[model samples]
Target: MRVTDLTLGILTLLGGIAIYLSAMNFQAIPGQEYGAGTMPRAVAFVTGLTGLYMIVEAIMSGNRGIGFRFAEWTRSGAALARVATVLLLILGYILVSPIVGFVPTTIVVLVVAMLTLGTRLVPAVIVSVVATIVIQQSFGKLLLVPLPRSDFLSFLW
Candidate 1:
């Protein structure tokens, strides 16, 4: 766990740095308000600070457990399979969204992911469908963000 913490800390630090650098690309807005980069830069700074704290804590504790040994293919294979499944599901949604539309695509993706994560079929399907509708409505109506909707489901609009 210590080694895992250290690794994650290092990765977080690197990611924070990357985010900070990327945020530099956004130009600051004039006198009225904050620029697009402001929030991201702030988040990056905080993340980097937290990561540094984690590293310092790890070093001070001196608990060096067994680190990552890729010699064991079983764990690595399982991790890869999980990642691949998620990627495939996401890709499937992107490909099918235009045809079946956003709600259906999102429903299918969510259900598959929930099932893959070991949820029972009935509950998974129910939760997935409900959550998709809620999220879609929240974003489309409350947030006023236009979500893709099928022409067939135009009545909802």
Candidate 2:
């Protein structure tokens, strides 16, 4: 199940480039020495450096080239099942969110995900419900972002 550090480093380097590119578009503050983009750009620079170091470390570990194989899912049905279930859950969430509203959709996804991962029924239900509420509040209330309300639920909205 161990992945190659070189692959991770390459991915991290790409991520850093993305962050830096996005940060470049951020508007700079007129009076402030550091603009909104400064900190993010700095982080991106660090990520790039760290990724480079990881690549070098991987090489120094005597591991040759990039072809690290994944754990054989064909040999482990349970592992494959778990991965498939999570992917399906994510797909369902995307398709359902705008139809049922974010709160209800998130609740269902979290519950299903926990159950699929073999969590106990009672704990899964409790955690799913709590997590759903917290996420809703965090995005909807604290962040002042309005969640999508289904047309079917328009009356409630």
Candidate 3:
């Protein structure tokens, strides 16, 4: 389905408002002018401005038909299946990650996603492993965020 610019603009504006409100709750950084919320607030401000511009442009265009339109892809079974597969994959990742640990779960999910999207097994495996490690290191080490860990994979830690 295709949404009209006005509808999308309104949604974006609401999302920006929500983000800005949530960011307001972030604690201020000690001796720092900007806290963690600073970047989020800035991004939300830009998003809100963009949404307002879209809303204005849509209003000025004089194209007031419907808020949304059904697209041809909605009738395609293959297209729908691909979308469902992606969604199911995300659900599976969310459900399994804590139990299986981030590295293994991510690698498995990536490999399956790549294979389903027609990538060769060897390349998918290689890419999944490398990408998982990079993501783990980036978030767990560089960002100082703790990721789910497995006792069996303690060597990686």
The model with the greatest lDDT is: 3
TM-score, every prediction: 0.50, 0.55, 0.56
lDDT per residue as tens, model 1, 1-117: 124666667778888999999998887787745799999999999999988887777777884442544445446766678778999998898788878877878888989888888
Error of 2 at 69 (Å): 1.9
- All candidates in order of TM-score, best leading: 3, 2, 1
Model 3: weakest 10-residue lDDT segment is 62-71
Q: Which scores better on lDDT, 1 or 2?
A: 2
Once model 2 is optimally superposed onto the true structure by TM-score, how far is the C-alpha of residue 84 displaced, in angstroms? 1.2
Indicate the TM-score of model 2.
Answer: 0.55
Residue 19 lDDT in candidate 3:
90
Deviation in Å, model 3, residue 127 alpha carbon: 0.5
**Whole-model lDDT per candidate:** 0.79, 0.81, 0.86
TM-score of 3: 0.56
lDDT per residue for candidate 3 within 15-120, as digits (tens), equals 8898999999887799987899999999999999988888888888975544788799989887788788889989998999889888888888899889878899
How many pairs of residues collide in each model? 0, 0, 0
Model 3 scores what on Cα lDDT?
A: 0.86
Write one digit per residue (lDDT tens) for candidate 2, span 1-157.
Answer: 6558898888889889999999997877897767889989999999999989888898899764675676767468888888888998899988888778887787788988898888999999999988877776688668877886555424433
